[model samples]
Target chain A: MHFSPILLHIPDGFLSTIVSLISWAITIAILSVAVKRTEKLDEKQVPLMGIMAAFIFAAQMINFPVAGGTSGHLLGGVLAAILLGPWAGMLVMTAVIGVQGLLLQDGGLLVMGANILNMGLLTAAIGFGLYKVGDGRKRTLKLGLAGLGAWLSVMAGALTTSLQLWLSGTARLDIVLPAMLGVHAVIGIGETLITVSALAFIFRTRPDLLDPAEGPARGGRGWIFVGAAISLFVLILSPLASSNPDGLERVAGDLGFLAQGKDAPFSILPDYTLPFLGEGAFSTIAAGIIGALVVAILVFFIIQSLRTAKKNA
Target chain B: MHSNIFDRYLHNNSSIHRLAPQVKVVIAILFIFSNALLPDGDWLSFAISWAVILLLNWLARLNLGYTLKRSLIVLPFTLAAITALFSVPGKTLTIWQIGSLELILTDAGLIRFLSIIVRSWLSVQIAILLVATTKFPDLIHALEHLRLPKMLVTVIAFLYRYMSVLTDEVIRLMRARQARSAVLPGRNGGGSLLWRARTAGNMVGQLFLRSYERSDRIYHAMLSRGYSGHLRTLNQHELNINDWLIIALAFLLIAFLQLFAHSIG
Candidate 1:
């Protein structure tokens, strides 16, 4: 029922050490190829790369609300892939997740690979496939397709994460699949709007930059209406998001993790609930709003630092 | 750029830090996998996992204090996941209640929770250690050798390269916001929530626009440099006896933990 601003993903217990390590290894392997691949690029691209990566990191902090008290952030993998090539986009998304894990504590280091695969590669690759399917034709249609791709990928990522939990034997199949699919069905709408709107704007103003593989094409605002209408749908329908336990909870209950998932010892607040902020509908909304702002600020700092570095370099 | 930050975690001179990147990469993954898989109830297995990671930390000569700070971020999620148990009431698990929500913090539950926390802490630390020790490039190089999809690996590398630059654009947008409105402590009249909201909207728009432009530049750059979308990396030297020994030992330890956890669970 609460909107966790800083997404509390992949609770430590759900993943085994081996799972964590293997994923970490996978993350590194991918990252290295990214660097090697980029070695031949101009010095100019390096600074640009840093900036885009910062943008992805910052984007996560700015979340939009949906029904069911659940809000989602910009899963940058798809968008990044569209802008940068899939590899670069994936790396940038990973960097965002990496910094969030290491410095911000937004995601877990143990589950870094999962985070990357989910948010970065899955969304980007899937979205690219869908975008190609639409053939980058009209603006409204292209943007619409982009939004659908974005939304689907977010849900896809969530579903995959749930599967990982199941594979780890931390949760049961019966619980993880249905529950994860449900919440994400709503979350995907929010994702669709944000991603589609952003892409639409870019497609209209600077169609040249969109889809590294495709050339400039007509972009339009009708798609914006589609995106807005979807947002409106979310605005109207989000309140109905099931109060049933999320995928993690469902699995935890059936598997053994439900009992094991505990709060950290050092947090000022016992749960995500703030002491001053009483737990209620009003409080949840307030927290969600505040959480969005907080992410905005954190993202601002990360981007700011990157800009300074660019200048100095 | 901020490539240094990528290198910042690695490039240390300690023996643990100097160990083969591939070996460390493999070991770190196994360590985390085992940590996640180990049953919740066993105290000894958790202790041993912790002990092993701590030993590695000591050998790596990591900045324990600084690393502790880094690990603090994941702490909250770990705490929150267990929140429901404290609220769902029953005669079963250990009992606790928050308002109407009854929780079962049973002895078994508490033990299970502890194992999760310990496992997360250890696994994350090991990751930090891997980055903290191995140069970012070498880690990726090891991965390339390990048969990762090159396309995906290339994506990660690019993000690391460019994320910082975009961060600056965001800062400038925010600073411009504070400049027009009041941001200083004494003059804090203009920085109300509404104003901040307006600024946030503008910033997101601006960010999207700027990112779009940057992509244009990057695309041209990619073509100019003859990026055929295929990244070919120079493979590192093969793993040696030490690497095999490390991998073997890591697997053995993981196996041992699994057996121990089963016996206790």
Candidate 2:
């Protein structure tokens, strides 16, 4: 079986009852908020939102070939979030997913809530959250941020799906977490490329559609906090992944990174932590925080340099 | 071209088709829920649920072979559950030794994996039966009647209405791309993977612009036709005696099935 790990629409029976219920609760809550946020939307915008949902549905059909005869398609969540604001983008995604489940039977009805939560709500939040930082920025900078948002949105979806599977006892955490992330890490690159290109196309043509003033207002810095919380959660869970060394070895072996089931060539954090901090939970978290800070600072400097370069130009 | 295949509803006057959309929707979801709640390796319950699904398919007067084939859509997703075949622990069914590594498959693991496949298959069939028997418009109406959020309902209505239109647009775009992207013998057609992705992305962007423009025209047309903020539908279905009877019967049947399954297990 050609197991494509980026399975977006989760069918039924994979998620346990409790997990499904929780996901449904979370999805419904967020959707209710989205509904309230779009309450004052003009009647004219309704058809536009609907048509946009259809557009996303159609856009997903254009599959580009990847290596080894496998193909990947656009998820369009981040793209929608960029065009529409986060709240409306989320609703559009919900509509698309809902139609997919009810009409096409692409996903299971029972698990549709989790499907929406994973693919619709989370992607919209992350995508719009990160993309909004590019408001009033240079075109390339905005597209770059959108690309980063798109890639992270895919990773977020994969991470949540792995958690759901593990929670349902359908798969082991050690196995599914890495497997899902590893595959999506590559697929996320495709997501980034497609999203950036699509936006670039939009930037060249009908640029008014991307105007923040025309779209919904930004949601402030709330999304950054959400992203931070999610990162922390992932950091907490990273230890569980590294705990099963055998799982990593097997994955490395399958990817042909290691020979004869041997150890990895190198480790970034050496079991996801600094050697000085030792192998405790606290050390792992501290290392993750430090690593995040370093990356953030580097990104800050890069953006600053880009702004200066644009000024000089 | 494949857009028509997505409209799985058969325009038939069978009993299942004649049932109220609300009732069918409720029962379908309940059936899926019951199936999800079934314990792994609960073969008896699985068998009973499969029987119920098959009976429903027969009642709907759908082509059994076609429905079965459509339900196979869930099989590819079963790959997501393949890890369970190796992860679950129990009596060792077999072990494969690759080099110094040992890969073990257990009886419990096999049962768990098979049960997941069966459960997903049965649940998907229930969904198929629901869609096959009810029209998409009626399904939307049923959701509205069931008190789903008004905005969501409206968005779904629009999506269903315009899916085919935009899908055709997409097909045209793809055909255009194909016409332009010709490959020489023993050579790749596209410049590179990135270029191909960019080409597809451009198509998507073009499609979005078209759809957006069409939506503007659609809204104006609706406005001219006296469309207010709220959408009013002609078919307002009330739960009649038969609808109530079917709901009650379904509720009892599902309850009994679950109770019996648990009792035996």
Candidate 3:
């Protein structure tokens, strides 16, 4: 597998324009609602949310090598969902994933929905479920289990994405499953470790920051706004994501769809580079930096706007 | 800096943002669902799809250059996937070699490839426009109102909030490495495998540590507030008449699009 785990790039032109647009629309709409609700929460919490969203985007950049010939990126949905709440987690993941599609093009615009469903919905939901069991009096045990669940679900998202590709007939099961699952399994261990560590850190550092009993903690609908603001910045570093093909690519190669990969005409941005704009890794690095800058600026303003709203309210 | 993306996207600034997330979600779902089922070769249907998207894009006022630039990441994946069509053993339109296997561009292969491209471009553009127009926070708020599972919504919200925090930490580490002689002399980075691998590991460790601390702080706050798992809040989400109109319009459009696809097929 040639996949670089730090980045899970879902290529464009895989899904049609309609799919991409609809996904964008849906995500934006949902994110907006999330923001509005989050705005209504403890106003002070907004900045904190911004910083946390940045953390997720940052974590996504770290790649771990896998068992086979590939690697897997961190599917941090479980970690986020467990800490924030599943709904909040999903919205944040979608925002990050959305910016990846729009700004960095880490994932295809068309399949944005599928991408969100995989990384956002699955990881967060599963992580949340697992975290719930562990969040009891035995928080240490809860944290441990939550870590395991988070790791498994990240792989589950990868598996689900693989299945979606295979089901769509663009990929073969035998090759994709082994290629994806194999590498992801190894990657999953790292995810588990990271989740456990993160959980431990949170539990140990400021356990009171996340107690469910807090009034604003319960009614912090305003956090939704903060989370959405964070999503923009979450993708600031997507251009830095590993350019290697993911699990699906290996599977596609082994199972036969590998040959289908080809360049497109009328495509303004090809090869993930601006084309004719410097060569080699420099352009890629430059793009990543610029992309990150763009995302960061966008998010800053978004947060600012939300802050204004809170003040006005 | 590129506020142009959003400025142009939300040409309508009155109340579209206040609509429920579910309506938009349902509309997007219906559109994509029918799109997937549509015949691959239906030029008319494709045209209709294109028309709808283009119209939406235009209405959103997105800068074509920015939108396209942002959309570039889709290329490699699309090309890679379409490249597979060349080897499906169908009627050969063109044949060549890239590395080892003979890459064949068959008619069926070509159609599959083209569909994938179209799908990628169109879908991404629309999605981008959607985000450009609607604010992100409002979108999630809408989802909560729509009866989307609270836990799921909360998870997504957190991921959105914290993803960037950790990434910056990675960059700082990268910068620290750059400060230490770096790889490319003045550039502060190298192409060495060992260096890259070490950096990746260290970065991962740091990310885990930072995120761990943040989650802990948030958890304690939750507990301090008397949270027993159920994230309770009284924020009510309402779908206004405009929202209903949007949903109805979406249904009508999808219905027509599906009908058009079937007739053409």
Give all TM-scores, in the order shown: 0.63, 0.88, 0.56
Better of 2 and 3 by TM-score: 2
Candidate 1 lDDT tens digits, B1-265: 3434324473457888767878887787777767777776566887888777778778888767767776665575553335323322233655555454444565654554566677777777777777788766676667667786554345446655554566556556656765776446765354433223333434565697777577667777777888665545575558888879878988987898788788767
Query: All models: lDDT?
Result: 0.56, 0.77, 0.54
Where does candidate 2 stray beyond 4 Å?
A1-5, A215-218, A231-313, B1-3, B98-101
Q: Which CAPRI category fits model 3?
A: incorrect
What are the root-mean-square deviations of the candidates from the true structure over C-alphas?
10.4, 5.7, 14.9
Error of 3 at A50 (Å): 11
Where's the lowest-lDDT run of ten residues in candidate 1 chain A? Answer: A235-244
**DockQ values for all predictions?**
0.26, 0.51, 0.17
True contacts kept of 3: 0.27
Model 2: per-residue lDDT, tens digit, A1-313? 1212258789988998989999999999999988887877777777788889999988888777778887667888899988888888999999999999888887778889999988899888877877767677888678777777776678678878977887687875555666676566577777776787778778878998888776343466677666556545555555435434455445534322111222111224545556787766677677656644544453344345434634775
Q: In candidate 1 chain B, what residue range of length 10 has the lowest lDDT sum? A: B190-199
lDDT of 3 by residue, B1-265 (tens): 2132222234455343344656755665566556666766676787788788666656555566766775554565553454436534567787776543355677876676677666666666655655666655556566567675554455445554444445556767756765864355567344433234334544554655565567668777867888554345455556678778898988888888888779767
lDDT of 3: 0.54
Q: Is candidate 2 or candidate 3 better by DockQ?
A: 2
List the TM values for chain B, per candidate. 0.82, 0.95, 0.79
For candidate 2, lDDT tens digit of each residue in B196-219? 766767787888889889999999
Candidate closest to the true structure, highest lDDT: 2
